[model samples]
Target: MSHSKSFSLQKIINYIGGTLIFFGVTYFVYSNWLSLNDFFKIFSTLGVALAAYIVGALLYLNKEYDEVGSVFLMIAGLILPVGIFIAFKLTELITGINNLSVVSFSISLVAFLLIFFYFGRIILLLFTIIFASLLFFAVMELITTKLNYFFDDLIAYQLVVLGSSYILLGYYFDLIKKYNLTGSLYFFGVLFILSGSYFLSGILSFDSTLWKMIVGVIILLSFILSVPLQSKSFLYFGAIFLVLFLVDLSRRLTPFFGEAGWPLILISLGFLFILMGSLIFHMQKKIKK
Candidate 1:
């Protein structure tokens, strides 16, 4: 077979094998869901996770079957959260404290963190951090609402905190030479922070100039970050958001300019952007040469 054909066939076989194994496991456990107690369900799944991790670790350490070992360990990581979720819910049920999802997700985050500690897998760490922060904030909101301590801007502020923390954490990882941690963290980091900041601006009812300044600052920061991270997503999002801010600013200020200067400002901003792009291109060319 051709190389491309062989590669494709290998992928197909892997997918089929994975699906069959998963389906078999699911089929066995699912029918017993109603029949089994929480303890039984939790322990059985954890037993499988433990077995997979031990065998996978031994194989990985031997270095002869690294790929198989990695696959098995990843499988164990994937299975762990299900077991944790059940255990957390069981705890809450016994204690009569509600917010089961939040508690379960929090425990699941810890499970992923433990796996990351053992394996040092970047994706695992990133997802764990992301979900942990989100679940923490969500639980806080839930509790505050239950206790009648909720405020109108509380969750928005929490979102902002979450976003800023992600970005800072990404930078911290980068400084420590953890390169694998950057891409996903930065991508979602920008998403959450920017959206949160935008919402905050609306809630705060900032002046048009202040809004422009905020967007401009982030756009510049993203551009600066893109150079080091080599991430086009950051640049693209920055450019997109800058344009959106400009358009929104123009729309809001149109009445003050009696509609004539509104279009004029748009045209002016367009020319300014084009000029900036040309300058950046020339500067890059000069640096490269």
Candidate 2:
């Protein structure tokens, strides 16, 4: 019991200490911002990030201190992007690039990915994903703005594509037994797909029948895939989106159906829900087995 307590306590101290160091440096820089030259400002952040990363890498070699090392690594990851941004701004590179955010995120993504490959660390991979996502958005924004090709639903289409890509990546991670990373990918993937489809459905305006049909198909696919994938994330997100779709469909049908058809629709939907519940329960049981 004492040993377990001490272990937890040590972890808390390590985390707190790492956090304090990061904040202390940030505060010091912020406080001295007026007095510092551009060179000092840019290098301060980069230098600190490098120092933290090196310390973390060295500490990672000792098994007992590996977790503490991860805290420092995370600190480095968090600060590195800020440092990159400062460097880009100070160097006046933004004027040369069509999209500074895209360039910076690209650089950050590659750096983090290289570090992740060298260290085999999940936290670094998380940073890589974050920067990659930023790069995607930055590029999307640039394309839409520069080309003037952005329709009302362009973002929706982009999200659907991005979500599908995330799901495929999650599947690849699953193949390699990277379950921790897989859950996040699955979660964000489903979230983006459903949210995008929801927007495309024109729930408020009933603007697109084709998109509504597509949304229904996606919901069905989620439920169907959930059983095979053993993903409760898929099941629950599907159920929620299904309810939203039904609600919107019902609202749209109100004028056509009149008052008499309302009760019938409600009864039919209630039965459908019961059936869905039964299926979900059985599917979950099967997955557990």
Candidate 3:
């Protein structure tokens, strides 16, 4: 077979093999789950991970099949989180501390980050960052619940901070010579920030003026960042959200002007676009001159 065909065939084989392994292990575990003790149950899960990691380590250390070994190691890393989660549950059951599982998960996140960094995989690092952030939110909610800090809008504010952190980390990665990942990080960052902003805007919708201003600012900032980053993800998202924001603003103002206000805003926006375009054109021409 040709090289491309060979790769495709190998991929197919790998997928099929993986599916079989998954089903076989799942069936065996479920069928035997009733008879297994707690210790056995916990260790079995962790043992698979440990075994995978050890074999993968051996393969890579020998350098005979480095890429395949790396794949196995990656698989082990994926399963490590599951084992950690299970360990967390066991700890919770034993300690009887309602939210102490967060500590277990925190440890897992730290260990995974260290292990992935040692392995030197940017994609894995990205996955870990995204996963750890989700767990971070989970921990936040748990702590808040224990502390009785329930507020309807608290989650949005936290999300805004989290989104800002992602943006900062994206820039940090860019500084370290990982340019390709900045787009992914920034895209997710924008998504989270915009989401939080939307929620906050909804909560503040009683003030119609503020709603329009908030959404307009989001659109402007998202598009502005896109210009410097040259990221299509931000450009497209900003455009889509701008339309949604305008529609929402129109809907919120329907009590004041019925449907007429929508048309007026649309027309004004059109003229504003024209004016901005002309100014930009003139500026570019002047700069070139």
Candidate 4:
């Protein structure tokens, strides 16, 4: 217990220090941006990233200082993309917000993933996920702009696909006993799935029975999966989205059913909420057992 506590505390301290250093350097660069020459501008960011990465690699060789080494690595992770972006911009290789962002993020993603594989550093996996997400968005944006292929619910479909992938990846991570990574992926996965489904359900647009049915099924599955996954996040988000769906359904029905149906809607939703609460409570008990 003591060792675990110490490990946790050390990680917290290292992360805090890393964050401060990143921000401090960022501020100094921003403050001196105009005064610095082109060389300094490029060096300040890339130079720091390189130095931090080298130091992190050296420190990571010692088991006792691995967490501190991770802090430096994280600093590298945070700055490397900015460095790449700046370098590309300065070289006139990137003119605007186009494929350049994708290229930069792809490089960062590959770098972090390779480092993680070599060192087995979980922290690098965080960067891997972040850069991968950025790359996905950049690619999507490029497609939207270049192809002019933006369609209704196009982004929603993309989110659903991404969310499904994240959910599966979370399960894989859980199988490997990477609980922290699992939780992060699960949280974002559910959020993206629910958010995309909500929009696709036509809550903000026209009513569609098909989408409503699909969303309802998704919510039901979320609740069911919670027990098997041992993930409260799935349960909680399921309930939250359930409420939102019900409220939206009621609003959509208000005009059709008239004011007389308002009372019925409220009473029905009330009963439904009670029933769901009871079911969830039982599920939680079963999960504990």
For model 3, the superposed segments whose C-alpha errors exceed 4 Å read 1-35, 58-66, 91-100, 203-212, 258-289
Worst 10 residues of 3 by lDDT: 280-289
Most lDDT-accurate candidate: 4
Q: Find the 10 residues in a row with the least total lDDT in model 4.
A: 203-212
What TM-score should be assigned to candidate 2? 0.85
Q: What is the lDDT of every predicted structure here?
A: 0.66, 0.82, 0.66, 0.86
Q: Estimate each model's TM-score.
A: 0.69, 0.85, 0.74, 0.92
Better of 2 and 4 by TM-score: 4
Candidates sorted on TM-score, descending: 4, 2, 3, 1
Scored by lDDT, model 1 comes in at 0.66
- The whole-model C-alpha lDDT of candidate 2 against the native structure comes to 0.82
Better of 1 and 4 by TM-score: 4
- Deviating ranges (above 4 Å) for candidate 1: 1-59, 87-98, 152-155, 203-213, 228-231, 259-262, 276-289
For candidate 1, lDDT tens digit of each residue in 1-289?
8988986676566546645655665676688888988777776676666676677667766665655565555556656555556666665653323465576567658766776787776545655785588577758867886897858767656766776777788778778987576666677778766666666566333444564477668777876766666565566666666666666666666678774976788887889789757745544443322
Best by TM-score: 4
Q: Could you tell me the lDDT of residue 114 within candidate 2?
A: 83
